[model samples]
Target: MTRLTETARGVYVIAATPFTDSGEIDFDSCDRMVDFYLDAGATGLTVLGIMGEAPKLTTDESSTIVARILKRVNGRVPVVVGASAPGFAQMQDLTRRVMDAGAAGVMVAPPGSLRTDDQIVTYYTQVAEFLGDTPFVVQDFPLTTGVQMAVPALARIFNSLPTAVCLKHEDWPGLAKITALRKDGTLNRRISILCGNGGVFLPEEMERGADGAMTGFAYPEMMVSVVEHHAKGDMERARDLFDAYLPLARMEQQPGAGLAIRKYIMFRRGIIASPAQRKPGANLDALSRAEIDTLMARLDRRLKELA
Candidate 1:
Protein backbone atom coordinates (compact mmCIF):
# COMPACT_ATOMS: atom_id res chain seq x y z
CA MET A 1 0.00 0.00 0.00
CA THR A 2 1.13 3.54 -0.76
CA ARG A 3 2.12 5.60 2.24
CA LEU A 4 -0.58 7.73 3.76
CA THR A 5 1.82 10.64 4.01
CA GLU A 6 2.59 10.65 0.29
CA THR A 7 1.06 14.10 0.02
CA ALA A 8 1.35 16.12 -3.20
CA ARG A 9 1.67 19.84 -3.76
CA GLY A 10 1.83 22.47 -6.53
CA VAL A 11 0.21 22.34 -10.00
CA TYR A 12 -1.05 18.80 -10.61
CA VAL A 13 -2.61 18.12 -14.00
CA ILE A 14 -5.81 16.11 -14.08
CA ALA A 15 -5.44 14.44 -17.49
CA ALA A 16 -8.01 14.07 -20.25
CA THR A 17 -8.91 10.42 -20.84
CA PRO A 18 -7.79 9.28 -24.28
CA PHE A 19 -10.04 7.04 -26.35
CA THR A 20 -9.00 4.88 -29.30
CA ASP A 21 -10.51 5.25 -32.77
CA SER A 22 -12.46 2.09 -32.05
CA GLY A 23 -13.97 3.79 -28.96
CA GLU A 24 -12.04 1.53 -26.61
CA ILE A 25 -9.86 2.87 -23.78
CA ASP A 26 -6.48 3.82 -25.17
CA PHE A 27 -4.04 2.46 -22.62
CA ASP A 28 -0.99 3.32 -24.70
CA SER A 29 -2.08 6.93 -25.10
CA CYS A 30 -2.84 7.06 -21.43
CA ASP A 31 0.71 5.99 -20.62
CA ARG A 32 2.17 8.59 -22.99
CA MET A 33 -0.05 11.30 -21.53
CA VAL A 34 1.08 10.45 -18.02
CA ASP A 35 4.73 10.68 -19.01
CA PHE A 36 4.07 13.93 -20.90
CA TYR A 37 2.57 15.70 -17.90
CA LEU A 38 5.12 14.39 -15.40
CA ASP A 39 8.01 15.56 -17.59
CA ALA A 40 6.23 18.90 -17.86
CA GLY A 41 6.60 19.05 -14.03
CA ALA A 42 3.18 18.36 -12.62
CA THR A 43 3.37 17.90 -8.84
CA GLY A 44 1.19 14.84 -9.38
CA LEU A 45 -1.78 13.64 -11.43
CA THR A 46 -5.47 13.08 -10.66
CA VAL A 47 -6.75 10.60 -13.22
CA LEU A 48 -10.43 9.87 -13.87
CA GLY A 49 -11.29 13.30 -12.51
CA ILE A 50 -13.88 15.51 -14.18
CA MET A 51 -11.52 16.25 -17.06
CA GLY A 52 -11.02 12.52 -17.47
CA GLU A 53 -14.79 12.23 -18.06
CA ALA A 54 -15.34 10.26 -14.86
CA PRO A 55 -19.11 10.45 -15.15
CA LYS A 56 -19.09 8.95 -18.62
CA LEU A 57 -16.71 6.06 -17.94
CA THR A 58 -17.83 2.63 -16.86
CA THR A 59 -16.64 1.03 -13.59
CA ASP A 60 -14.19 -1.30 -15.33
CA GLU A 61 -13.01 1.53 -17.57
CA SER A 62 -12.25 3.74 -14.58
CA SER A 63 -10.28 0.95 -12.95
CA THR A 64 -8.32 0.39 -16.14
CA ILE A 65 -7.51 4.08 -16.48
CA VAL A 66 -6.19 4.26 -12.93
CA ALA A 67 -4.15 1.13 -13.48
CA ARG A 68 -2.63 2.59 -16.64
CA ILE A 69 -1.69 5.80 -14.85
CA LEU A 70 -0.12 3.93 -11.95
CA LYS A 71 1.88 1.76 -14.29
CA ARG A 72 3.15 4.79 -16.14
CA VAL A 73 3.89 6.86 -13.06
CA ASN A 74 5.61 3.96 -11.27
CA GLY A 75 5.19 5.79 -7.96
CA ARG A 76 7.37 8.67 -9.08
CA VAL A 77 4.59 10.98 -7.90
CA PRO A 78 1.33 10.37 -6.14
CA VAL A 79 -1.75 9.65 -8.26
CA VAL A 80 -5.23 10.53 -7.06
CA VAL A 81 -7.80 8.31 -8.77
CA GLY A 82 -11.40 9.42 -9.00
CA ALA A 83 -13.96 7.01 -7.49
CA SER A 84 -17.21 8.89 -7.71
CA ALA A 85 -19.77 6.14 -8.02
CA PRO A 86 -23.48 6.86 -7.83
CA GLY A 87 -23.87 4.20 -5.18
CA PHE A 88 -21.87 3.62 -2.02
CA ALA A 89 -20.99 -0.01 -2.68
CA GLN A 90 -19.63 0.72 -6.14
CA MET A 91 -17.66 3.71 -4.90
CA GLN A 92 -16.10 1.61 -2.17
CA ASP A 93 -15.29 -1.16 -4.61
CA LEU A 94 -13.62 1.25 -7.03
CA THR A 95 -11.66 2.84 -4.21
CA ARG A 96 -10.38 -0.57 -3.12
CA ARG A 97 -9.42 -1.51 -6.67
CA VAL A 98 -7.62 1.80 -7.27
CA MET A 99 -5.69 1.45 -4.04
CA ASP A 100 -4.89 -2.12 -4.97
CA ALA A 101 -3.89 -0.82 -8.40
CA GLY A 102 -1.27 1.39 -6.65
CA ALA A 103 -2.93 4.80 -6.55
CA ALA A 104 -1.45 6.87 -3.73
CA GLY A 105 -4.85 8.32 -2.93
CA VAL A 106 -8.44 8.58 -4.14
CA MET A 107 -10.51 11.70 -4.90
CA VAL A 108 -14.28 11.34 -4.60
CA ALA A 109 -17.14 13.73 -5.13
CA PRO A 110 -20.51 13.58 -3.39
CA PRO A 111 -22.72 10.79 -4.68
CA GLY A 112 -24.93 11.32 -7.70
CA SER A 113 -28.77 11.62 -7.41
CA LEU A 114 -28.19 12.48 -3.79
CA ARG A 115 -28.89 16.03 -2.60
CA THR A 116 -28.90 16.83 1.12
CA ASP A 117 -25.63 18.04 2.66
CA ASP A 118 -26.00 15.40 5.35
CA GLN A 119 -26.25 12.73 2.71
CA ILE A 120 -23.12 14.00 1.02
CA VAL A 121 -21.17 14.02 4.27
CA THR A 122 -22.44 10.62 5.27
CA TYR A 123 -21.59 9.15 1.89
CA TYR A 124 -18.02 10.45 2.03
CA THR A 125 -17.62 9.39 5.65
CA GLN A 126 -18.67 5.86 4.85
CA VAL A 127 -16.50 5.74 1.77
CA ALA A 128 -13.54 6.97 3.78
CA GLU A 129 -14.18 4.30 6.34
CA PHE A 130 -14.28 1.61 3.70
CA LEU A 131 -10.88 2.62 2.38
CA GLY A 132 -9.35 2.29 5.87
CA ASP A 133 -5.83 3.71 5.51
CA THR A 134 -5.92 5.38 2.10
CA PRO A 135 -5.90 9.14 1.65
CA PHE A 136 -9.15 10.78 0.48
CA VAL A 137 -9.71 14.09 -1.29
CA VAL A 138 -13.14 15.66 -0.98
CA GLN A 139 -13.91 16.87 -4.49
CA ASP A 140 -16.12 19.99 -4.42
CA PHE A 141 -17.32 20.87 -7.90
CA PRO A 142 -20.67 22.59 -7.60
CA LEU A 143 -21.08 22.92 -11.36
CA THR A 144 -21.11 19.17 -11.92
CA THR A 145 -22.17 17.77 -8.55
CA GLY A 146 -25.31 19.99 -8.44
CA VAL A 147 -24.68 20.58 -4.72
CA GLN A 148 -22.07 22.48 -2.78
CA MET A 149 -20.68 21.68 0.67
CA ALA A 150 -21.24 24.49 3.09
CA VAL A 151 -18.44 25.54 5.43
CA PRO A 152 -20.02 23.99 8.48
CA ALA A 153 -20.65 20.79 6.60
CA LEU A 154 -17.08 20.70 5.42
CA ALA A 155 -15.80 21.35 8.91
CA ARG A 156 -17.86 18.49 10.23
CA ILE A 157 -16.69 16.13 7.52
CA PHE A 158 -13.02 17.01 7.95
CA ASN A 159 -13.26 16.73 11.70
CA SER A 160 -14.66 13.24 11.30
CA LEU A 161 -12.09 11.67 8.98
CA PRO A 162 -8.44 11.04 9.72
CA THR A 163 -7.74 9.96 6.15
CA ALA A 164 -9.17 13.12 4.55
CA VAL A 165 -5.97 14.64 3.22
CA CYS A 166 -7.21 17.49 1.00
CA LEU A 167 -10.12 19.38 -0.47
CA LYS A 168 -10.36 19.88 -4.24
CA HIS A 169 -12.07 23.24 -3.89
CA GLU A 170 -13.64 24.05 -7.30
CA ASP A 171 -15.91 26.85 -6.14
CA TRP A 172 -14.14 30.21 -5.74
CA PRO A 173 -16.12 31.33 -2.73
CA GLY A 174 -15.87 27.83 -1.34
CA LEU A 175 -12.13 28.01 -1.68
CA ALA A 176 -12.29 31.25 0.24
CA LYS A 177 -14.23 29.46 2.92
CA ILE A 178 -11.61 26.73 3.07
CA THR A 179 -8.88 29.31 3.47
CA ALA A 180 -10.95 30.91 6.18
CA LEU A 181 -11.24 27.58 7.93
CA ARG A 182 -7.49 27.16 7.97
CA LYS A 183 -6.94 30.74 9.12
CA ASP A 184 -9.38 30.39 11.95
CA GLY A 185 -7.80 27.16 13.23
CA THR A 186 -10.84 25.13 12.26
CA LEU A 187 -9.13 23.09 9.54
CA ASN A 188 -6.12 21.03 10.44
CA ARG A 189 -2.80 22.38 9.25
CA ARG A 190 -1.95 19.03 7.70
CA ILE A 191 -4.90 19.10 5.32
CA SER A 192 -4.08 20.76 1.99
CA ILE A 193 -6.45 22.67 -0.32
CA LEU A 194 -6.04 22.01 -4.05
CA CYS A 195 -7.62 24.57 -6.39
CA GLY A 196 -9.93 22.90 -8.94
CA ASN A 197 -11.66 25.27 -11.38
CA GLY A 198 -9.29 24.57 -14.26
CA GLY A 199 -6.45 26.74 -12.94
CA VAL A 200 -8.63 29.78 -13.72
CA PHE A 201 -8.33 31.17 -10.17
CA LEU A 202 -5.07 29.48 -9.26
CA PRO A 203 -3.05 32.67 -8.85
CA GLU A 204 -5.71 34.19 -6.65
CA GLU A 205 -6.07 31.01 -4.62
CA MET A 206 -2.33 30.70 -4.22
CA GLU A 207 -2.16 34.28 -3.03
CA ARG A 208 -5.03 33.55 -0.65
CA GLY A 209 -2.96 30.59 0.69
CA ALA A 210 -4.17 27.65 -1.38
CA ASP A 211 -1.59 24.88 -1.65
CA GLY A 212 -1.91 24.18 -5.39
CA ALA A 213 -4.17 23.66 -8.39
CA MET A 214 -5.43 20.63 -10.38
CA THR A 215 -6.15 21.57 -13.99
CA GLY A 216 -6.11 19.31 -17.07
CA PHE A 217 -5.68 22.10 -19.62
CA ALA A 218 -2.03 22.65 -18.67
CA TYR A 219 -0.83 19.37 -20.03
CA PRO A 220 2.70 20.26 -21.37
CA GLU A 221 4.34 23.31 -19.84
CA MET A 222 2.33 26.42 -19.02
CA MET A 223 0.84 24.71 -15.96
CA VAL A 224 4.30 23.83 -14.69
CA SER A 225 5.48 27.34 -15.55
CA VAL A 226 2.72 28.93 -13.51
CA VAL A 227 3.45 26.87 -10.41
CA GLU A 228 7.20 27.18 -10.78
CA HIS A 229 6.89 30.92 -11.17
CA HIS A 230 4.74 31.18 -8.08
CA ALA A 231 7.04 28.93 -6.11
CA LYS A 232 9.94 31.17 -7.05
CA GLY A 233 8.02 34.19 -5.66
CA ASP A 234 7.08 35.60 -9.08
CA MET A 235 3.45 36.16 -8.21
CA GLU A 236 3.05 38.93 -10.77
CA ARG A 237 4.29 36.75 -13.63
CA ALA A 238 2.19 33.83 -12.49
CA ARG A 239 -0.99 35.85 -12.22
CA ASP A 240 -0.31 37.43 -15.60
CA LEU A 241 0.04 33.99 -17.20
CA PHE A 242 -3.16 32.82 -15.53
CA ASP A 243 -5.17 35.85 -16.71
CA ALA A 244 -3.67 35.79 -20.19
CA TYR A 245 -4.82 32.24 -20.66
CA LEU A 246 -8.34 33.02 -19.40
CA PRO A 247 -9.88 32.68 -22.88
CA LEU A 248 -8.30 29.28 -23.35
CA ALA A 249 -9.43 28.36 -19.88
CA ARG A 250 -13.02 29.45 -20.58
CA MET A 251 -13.04 27.49 -23.80
CA GLU A 252 -11.99 24.44 -21.80
CA GLN A 253 -14.83 24.95 -19.31
CA GLN A 254 -17.68 24.76 -21.81
CA PRO A 255 -19.30 21.34 -21.50
CA GLY A 256 -18.69 19.27 -24.67
CA ALA A 257 -16.10 21.98 -25.15
CA GLY A 258 -13.32 21.40 -22.57
CA LEU A 259 -11.77 18.15 -23.76
CA ALA A 260 -12.21 19.03 -27.43
CA ILE A 261 -10.37 22.33 -27.09
CA ARG A 262 -7.59 20.79 -24.98
CA LYS A 263 -7.22 17.91 -27.42
CA TYR A 264 -6.97 20.30 -30.40
CA ILE A 265 -4.31 22.31 -28.62
CA MET A 266 -2.52 19.06 -27.82
CA PHE A 267 -2.76 18.09 -31.48
CA ARG A 268 -1.30 21.45 -32.44
CA ARG A 269 1.45 20.72 -29.94
CA GLY A 270 1.82 17.28 -31.57
CA ILE A 271 0.98 15.34 -28.40
CA ILE A 272 -2.11 13.26 -29.17
CA ALA A 273 -3.05 11.02 -32.13
CA SER A 274 -5.71 13.26 -33.74
CA PRO A 275 -7.71 14.94 -30.95
CA ALA A 276 -10.55 12.70 -32.06
CA GLN A 277 -12.90 11.96 -29.17
CA ARG A 278 -15.51 9.22 -29.40
CA LYS A 279 -19.07 9.96 -30.49
CA PRO A 280 -21.25 12.34 -28.38
CA GLY A 281 -18.18 14.23 -27.06
CA ALA A 282 -16.26 14.94 -30.23
CA ASN A 283 -15.17 18.40 -31.38
CA LEU A 284 -17.70 21.11 -32.07
CA ASP A 285 -19.43 21.49 -35.45
CA ALA A 286 -18.10 23.44 -38.43
CA LEU A 287 -19.09 26.88 -37.09
CA SER A 288 -17.86 26.04 -33.60
CA ARG A 289 -14.61 24.73 -35.01
CA ALA A 290 -14.21 27.93 -37.04
CA GLU A 291 -14.63 30.05 -33.89
CA ILE A 292 -12.21 27.82 -31.95
CA ASP A 293 -9.69 28.06 -34.76
CA THR A 294 -9.92 31.86 -34.69
CA LEU A 295 -9.47 31.98 -30.93
CA MET A 296 -6.67 29.43 -31.02
CA ALA A 297 -4.87 31.36 -33.73
CA ARG A 298 -5.10 34.56 -31.72
CA LEU A 299 -3.90 32.80 -28.58
CA ASP A 300 -1.04 31.16 -30.44
CA ARG A 301 0.11 34.53 -31.77
CA ARG A 302 -0.13 36.09 -28.33
CA LEU A 303 1.82 33.20 -26.81
CA LYS A 304 4.57 33.77 -29.36
CA GLU A 305 4.66 37.45 -28.49
CA LEU A 306 5.12 36.53 -24.84
CA ALA A 307 7.87 34.09 -25.76
Candidate 2:
Protein backbone atom coordinates (compact mmCIF):
# COMPACT_ATOMS: atom_id res chain seq x y z
CA MET A 1 0.00 0.00 0.00
CA THR A 2 1.19 3.52 -0.75
CA ARG A 3 1.50 5.32 2.54
CA LEU A 4 -0.53 8.53 2.55
CA THR A 5 0.18 11.39 4.89
CA GLU A 6 -2.71 13.57 5.93
CA THR A 7 -2.39 16.35 3.36
CA ALA A 8 -3.17 19.70 4.95
CA ARG A 9 -5.98 21.67 3.42
CA GLY A 10 -4.28 24.35 1.34
CA VAL A 11 -3.65 25.29 -2.27
CA TYR A 12 -2.31 22.11 -3.85
CA VAL A 13 -0.68 22.86 -7.20
CA ILE A 14 -1.77 20.81 -10.22
CA ALA A 15 1.71 20.24 -11.58
CA ALA A 16 1.74 20.81 -15.34
CA THR A 17 3.20 18.21 -17.64
CA PRO A 18 6.07 19.55 -19.70
CA PHE A 19 6.82 18.20 -23.16
CA THR A 20 9.90 18.01 -25.35
CA ASP A 21 10.08 19.64 -28.80
CA SER A 22 9.63 16.18 -30.32
CA GLY A 23 6.34 15.76 -28.41
CA GLU A 24 7.40 13.53 -25.53
CA ILE A 25 6.75 13.66 -21.77
CA ASP A 26 9.60 15.59 -20.20
CA PHE A 27 10.32 13.85 -16.91
CA ASP A 28 13.11 16.28 -16.04
CA SER A 29 10.82 19.27 -16.29
CA CYS A 30 8.02 17.39 -14.55
CA ASP A 31 10.30 16.83 -11.56
CA ARG A 32 11.19 20.51 -11.50
CA MET A 33 7.51 21.47 -11.42
CA VAL A 34 6.88 19.04 -8.54
CA ASP A 35 9.76 20.54 -6.62
CA PHE A 36 8.47 24.05 -7.24
CA TYR A 37 5.11 23.18 -5.71
CA LEU A 38 6.73 21.42 -2.74
CA ASP A 39 9.01 24.36 -2.06
CA ALA A 40 5.97 26.62 -2.38
CA GLY A 41 4.46 24.70 0.58
CA ALA A 42 1.60 23.19 -1.38
CA THR A 43 -0.42 20.61 0.50
CA GLY A 44 0.58 18.22 -2.27
CA LEU A 45 1.10 17.79 -6.01
CA THR A 46 -1.90 16.74 -8.15
CA VAL A 47 -0.41 15.22 -11.30
CA LEU A 48 -2.41 14.60 -14.51
CA GLY A 49 -5.26 16.83 -13.38
CA ILE A 50 -7.23 18.92 -15.88
CA MET A 51 -4.65 21.63 -15.39
CA GLY A 52 -2.06 18.94 -16.14
CA GLU A 53 -3.82 18.07 -19.45
CA ALA A 54 -5.09 14.69 -18.19
CA PRO A 55 -7.46 14.18 -21.11
CA LYS A 56 -4.84 14.68 -23.81
CA LEU A 57 -2.18 12.49 -22.25
CA THR A 58 -1.88 8.77 -23.04
CA THR A 59 -2.29 6.07 -20.37
CA ASP A 60 1.41 5.22 -20.46
CA GLU A 61 2.31 8.83 -20.03
CA SER A 62 -0.11 9.20 -17.13
CA SER A 63 1.23 6.16 -15.27
CA THR A 64 4.80 7.22 -15.96
CA ILE A 65 4.19 10.67 -14.57
CA VAL A 66 2.53 9.22 -11.48
CA ALA A 67 5.42 6.85 -10.91
CA ARG A 68 8.00 9.58 -11.30
CA ILE A 69 6.12 11.92 -9.00
CA LEU A 70 5.75 9.17 -6.44
CA LYS A 71 9.48 8.54 -6.49
CA ARG A 72 10.27 12.21 -6.24
CA VAL A 73 7.74 12.94 -3.54
CA ASN A 74 9.03 10.04 -1.41
CA GLY A 75 5.93 10.04 0.76
CA ARG A 76 6.34 13.62 1.92
CA VAL A 77 2.73 14.40 1.04
CA PRO A 78 -0.21 13.00 -0.87
CA VAL A 79 0.35 12.51 -4.62
CA VAL A 80 -3.04 12.31 -6.31
CA VAL A 81 -3.01 11.03 -9.91
CA GLY A 82 -5.84 11.37 -12.40
CA ALA A 83 -7.31 8.13 -13.80
CA SER A 84 -10.34 9.46 -15.63
CA ALA A 85 -11.40 8.10 -19.01
CA PRO A 86 -14.46 7.26 -21.14
CA GLY A 87 -14.41 3.54 -20.38
CA PHE A 88 -14.84 2.08 -16.91
CA ALA A 89 -12.49 -0.75 -17.65
CA GLN A 90 -9.75 1.63 -18.72
CA MET A 91 -10.16 3.81 -15.67
CA GLN A 92 -10.13 0.78 -13.37
CA ASP A 93 -7.02 -0.56 -15.01
CA LEU A 94 -5.38 2.88 -14.94
CA THR A 95 -6.20 3.31 -11.29
CA ARG A 96 -4.75 -0.07 -10.44
CA ARG A 97 -1.67 0.63 -12.53
CA VAL A 98 -1.00 3.96 -10.91
CA MET A 99 -1.51 2.51 -7.48
CA ASP A 100 0.89 -0.31 -8.23
CA ALA A 101 3.28 2.39 -9.34
CA GLY A 102 3.05 3.81 -5.78
CA ALA A 103 0.57 6.67 -6.04
CA ALA A 104 -0.80 7.71 -2.67
CA GLY A 105 -4.24 8.26 -4.14
CA VAL A 106 -6.21 8.70 -7.39
CA MET A 107 -8.68 11.34 -8.62
CA VAL A 108 -11.30 10.37 -11.21
CA ALA A 109 -14.29 11.93 -12.94
CA PRO A 110 -17.38 10.62 -14.70
CA PRO A 111 -16.34 8.96 -17.92
CA GLY A 112 -16.12 11.53 -20.71
CA SER A 113 -19.07 11.71 -23.18
CA LEU A 114 -21.26 9.60 -20.89
CA ARG A 115 -24.06 11.50 -19.19
CA THR A 116 -25.92 8.70 -17.44
CA ASP A 117 -25.74 8.93 -13.65
CA ASP A 118 -25.91 5.16 -13.31
CA GLN A 119 -22.98 4.75 -15.62
CA ILE A 120 -20.92 7.24 -13.64
CA VAL A 121 -21.63 5.52 -10.36
CA THR A 122 -21.02 2.09 -11.84
CA TYR A 123 -17.69 3.18 -13.27
CA TYR A 124 -16.55 4.62 -9.98
CA THR A 125 -17.82 1.59 -8.11
CA GLN A 126 -15.82 -0.77 -10.30
CA VAL A 127 -12.68 1.35 -10.05
CA ALA A 128 -13.04 1.59 -6.30
CA GLU A 129 -13.47 -2.15 -5.83
CA PHE A 130 -10.50 -2.92 -8.01
CA LEU A 131 -8.31 -0.48 -6.16
CA GLY A 132 -9.17 -2.30 -2.89
CA ASP A 133 -9.95 0.50 -0.43
CA THR A 134 -7.44 3.01 -1.73
CA PRO A 135 -8.35 6.64 -1.12
CA PHE A 136 -9.98 8.40 -4.08
CA VAL A 137 -11.09 11.92 -4.87
CA VAL A 138 -14.25 12.49 -6.86
CA GLN A 139 -13.30 15.10 -9.43
CA ASP A 140 -16.39 17.12 -10.41
CA PHE A 141 -15.83 18.81 -13.78
CA PRO A 142 -19.35 19.27 -15.19
CA LEU A 143 -18.06 21.38 -18.06
CA THR A 144 -16.34 18.28 -19.44
CA THR A 145 -17.98 15.32 -17.69
CA GLY A 146 -21.46 16.32 -19.05
CA VAL A 147 -22.96 14.85 -15.88
CA GLN A 148 -23.58 17.18 -12.99
CA MET A 149 -22.83 15.36 -9.75
CA ALA A 150 -26.07 15.75 -7.90
CA VAL A 151 -26.03 15.29 -4.13
CA PRO A 152 -27.81 11.96 -4.35
CA ALA A 153 -25.05 10.58 -6.55
CA LEU A 154 -22.33 11.88 -4.27
CA ALA A 155 -24.00 10.26 -1.28
CA ARG A 156 -24.50 6.93 -3.03
CA ILE A 157 -20.88 6.70 -4.20
CA PHE A 158 -19.41 7.78 -0.91
CA ASN A 159 -21.60 5.34 0.94
CA SER A 160 -20.41 2.52 -1.30
CA LEU A 161 -16.71 3.29 -0.93
CA PRO A 162 -16.00 3.85 2.73
CA THR A 163 -12.44 4.88 1.94
CA ALA A 164 -13.31 7.78 -0.38
CA VAL A 165 -11.42 10.64 1.21
CA CYS A 166 -11.71 13.85 -0.79
CA LEU A 167 -13.89 15.68 -3.30
CA LYS A 168 -12.30 17.85 -6.01
CA HIS A 169 -15.28 20.18 -6.01
CA GLU A 170 -15.59 21.90 -9.43
CA ASP A 171 -19.30 22.00 -10.28
CA TRP A 172 -20.19 25.62 -9.52
CA PRO A 173 -23.90 25.59 -8.70
CA GLY A 174 -23.33 22.11 -7.33
CA LEU A 175 -20.68 23.51 -5.05
CA ALA A 176 -23.53 24.67 -2.90
CA LYS A 177 -24.81 21.12 -2.92
CA ILE A 178 -21.57 19.94 -1.36
CA THR A 179 -21.70 22.65 1.26
CA ALA A 180 -25.28 21.63 1.94
CA LEU A 181 -24.20 18.05 2.48
CA ARG A 182 -21.65 19.19 5.01
CA LYS A 183 -24.07 21.58 6.64
CA ASP A 184 -26.89 19.04 6.82
CA GLY A 185 -24.69 16.15 7.95
CA THR A 186 -25.17 14.12 4.77
CA LEU A 187 -21.56 13.61 3.79
CA ASN A 188 -19.15 11.27 5.53
CA ARG A 189 -17.40 12.76 8.51
CA ARG A 190 -13.95 11.96 7.12
CA ILE A 191 -14.46 13.44 3.66
CA SER A 192 -12.44 16.59 3.01
CA ILE A 193 -13.29 19.03 0.21
CA LEU A 194 -10.65 20.57 -2.06
CA CYS A 195 -11.26 23.42 -4.48
CA GLY A 196 -10.11 22.55 -8.01
CA ASN A 197 -11.35 25.56 -9.93
CA GLY A 198 -8.13 27.44 -10.54
CA GLY A 199 -8.45 29.27 -7.19
CA VAL A 200 -10.72 31.91 -8.75
CA PHE A 201 -13.49 31.46 -6.18
CA LEU A 202 -11.45 29.78 -3.46
CA PRO A 203 -11.84 32.54 -0.89
CA GLU A 204 -15.58 32.59 -1.36
CA GLU A 205 -15.70 28.80 -1.18
CA MET A 206 -13.47 28.79 1.87
CA GLU A 207 -15.85 31.18 3.53
CA ARG A 208 -18.63 28.84 2.50
CA GLY A 209 -16.81 25.88 4.19
CA ALA A 210 -14.42 24.31 1.66
CA ASP A 211 -11.34 22.58 3.09
CA GLY A 212 -8.78 23.98 0.62
CA ALA A 213 -8.10 24.53 -3.08
CA MET A 214 -6.26 22.75 -5.85
CA THR A 215 -4.91 25.45 -8.16
CA GLY A 216 -2.79 25.36 -11.29
CA PHE A 217 0.04 27.82 -11.96
CA ALA A 218 0.32 28.57 -8.26
CA TYR A 219 3.10 30.64 -6.69
CA PRO A 220 3.28 28.59 -3.48
CA GLU A 221 4.21 31.43 -1.15
CA MET A 222 1.30 33.66 -2.10
CA MET A 223 -1.08 30.73 -2.37
CA VAL A 224 -0.16 29.47 1.06
CA SER A 225 -0.10 33.04 2.36
CA VAL A 226 -3.71 33.56 1.40
CA VAL A 227 -4.88 30.37 3.06
CA GLU A 228 -2.64 30.70 6.09
CA HIS A 229 -3.56 34.32 6.67
CA HIS A 230 -7.19 33.37 6.63
CA ALA A 231 -6.51 30.51 9.02
CA LYS A 232 -4.69 33.01 11.21
CA GLY A 233 -7.87 35.11 11.35
CA ASP A 234 -6.51 37.83 9.06
CA MET A 235 -9.25 37.82 6.48
CA GLU A 236 -8.33 41.30 5.25
CA ARG A 237 -4.77 40.36 4.35
CA ALA A 238 -5.97 37.17 2.70
CA ARG A 239 -8.43 39.12 0.59
CA ASP A 240 -5.71 41.59 -0.34
CA LEU A 241 -3.40 38.85 -1.58
CA PHE A 242 -6.28 37.20 -3.44
CA ASP A 243 -7.03 40.45 -5.25
CA ALA A 244 -3.38 41.03 -6.09
CA TYR A 245 -3.10 37.68 -7.88
CA LEU A 246 -6.52 37.75 -9.57
CA PRO A 247 -5.17 39.26 -12.79
CA LEU A 248 -2.52 36.59 -13.20
CA ALA A 249 -5.13 33.88 -12.61
CA ARG A 250 -7.43 35.36 -15.26
CA MET A 251 -4.65 35.65 -17.81
CA GLU A 252 -3.43 32.07 -17.42
CA GLN A 253 -6.90 30.53 -17.35
CA GLN A 254 -8.16 31.52 -20.78
CA PRO A 255 -9.96 28.54 -22.40
CA GLY A 256 -7.20 27.16 -24.62
CA ALA A 257 -4.41 28.55 -22.45
CA GLY A 258 -4.92 25.95 -19.67
CA LEU A 259 -1.66 24.22 -18.80
CA ALA A 260 0.25 25.88 -21.61
CA ILE A 261 -0.23 29.30 -20.13
CA ARG A 262 0.53 27.89 -16.67
CA LYS A 263 3.84 26.64 -18.00
CA TYR A 264 4.51 30.00 -19.59
CA ILE A 265 3.92 31.83 -16.32
CA MET A 266 6.16 29.35 -14.48
CA PHE A 267 8.85 29.97 -17.09
CA ARG A 268 8.41 33.71 -16.71
CA ARG A 269 8.76 33.20 -12.96
CA GLY A 270 12.02 31.30 -13.63
CA ILE A 271 10.72 28.04 -12.20
CA ILE A 272 10.66 25.63 -15.17
CA ALA A 273 12.01 24.69 -18.57
CA SER A 274 10.65 26.07 -21.85
CA PRO A 275 6.94 26.85 -21.93
CA ALA A 276 6.51 24.59 -24.97
CA GLN A 277 3.32 22.53 -24.85
CA ARG A 278 3.20 18.85 -25.83
CA LYS A 279 0.41 19.23 -28.34
CA PRO A 280 -0.54 21.78 -30.93
CA GLY A 281 -3.73 23.93 -30.92
CA ALA A 282 -2.33 25.56 -27.76
CA ASN A 283 -0.41 28.16 -29.72
CA LEU A 284 -0.99 31.57 -28.20
CA ASP A 285 -1.15 34.54 -30.52
CA ALA A 286 0.88 37.71 -30.04
CA LEU A 287 -1.94 39.38 -28.16
CA SER A 288 -2.22 36.62 -25.58
CA ARG A 289 1.55 36.42 -25.28
CA ALA A 290 1.95 40.14 -24.70
CA GLU A 291 -0.95 40.10 -22.25
CA ILE A 292 0.66 37.27 -20.29
CA ASP A 293 4.01 39.02 -20.32
CA THR A 294 2.60 42.28 -19.06
CA LEU A 295 0.52 40.64 -16.35
CA MET A 296 3.43 38.46 -15.21
CA ALA A 297 5.81 41.42 -15.03
CA ARG A 298 3.33 43.34 -12.93
CA LEU A 299 2.69 40.31 -10.72
CA ASP A 300 6.44 39.72 -10.26
CA ARG A 301 7.04 43.35 -9.32
CA ARG A 302 4.14 43.16 -6.90
CA LEU A 303 5.64 40.07 -5.32
CA LYS A 304 8.90 41.94 -4.80
CA GLU A 305 7.02 44.88 -3.29
CA LEU A 306 5.16 42.54 -0.97
CA ALA A 307 8.41 40.87 0.03
Worst 10 residues of 2 by lDDT: 1-10
Q: Candidate 2's C-alpha lDDT?
A: 0.74
lDDT by residue for model 1 (125-211), tens:
888777788888888888877877787778778878878878888875564675666776676545777887777767777777777
Residue pairs clashing in model 2 are none
For all predictions, the C-alpha RMSD in Å is: 2.3, 2.3
RMSD of 1: 2.3
- Quote the lDDT for 296 in model 2: 71
Q: Which ranges in model 1 have alpha carbons more than 4 Å from their true place?
A: 1-7, 112-116, 172-175, 218-220
Q: What is the C-alpha local distance difference test score of each model?
A: 0.75, 0.74
Candidate 2 per-residue lDDT over residues 32-89, each given as its tens digit: 8777788888877788887777777778878888888888888777777877776667
Compared with the true structure, the alpha-carbon lDDT of candidate 1 equals 0.75
Measured against the true structure, the TM-scores of the candidates, in listed sequence, are 0.90, 0.90
Total clashes for model 2: 0
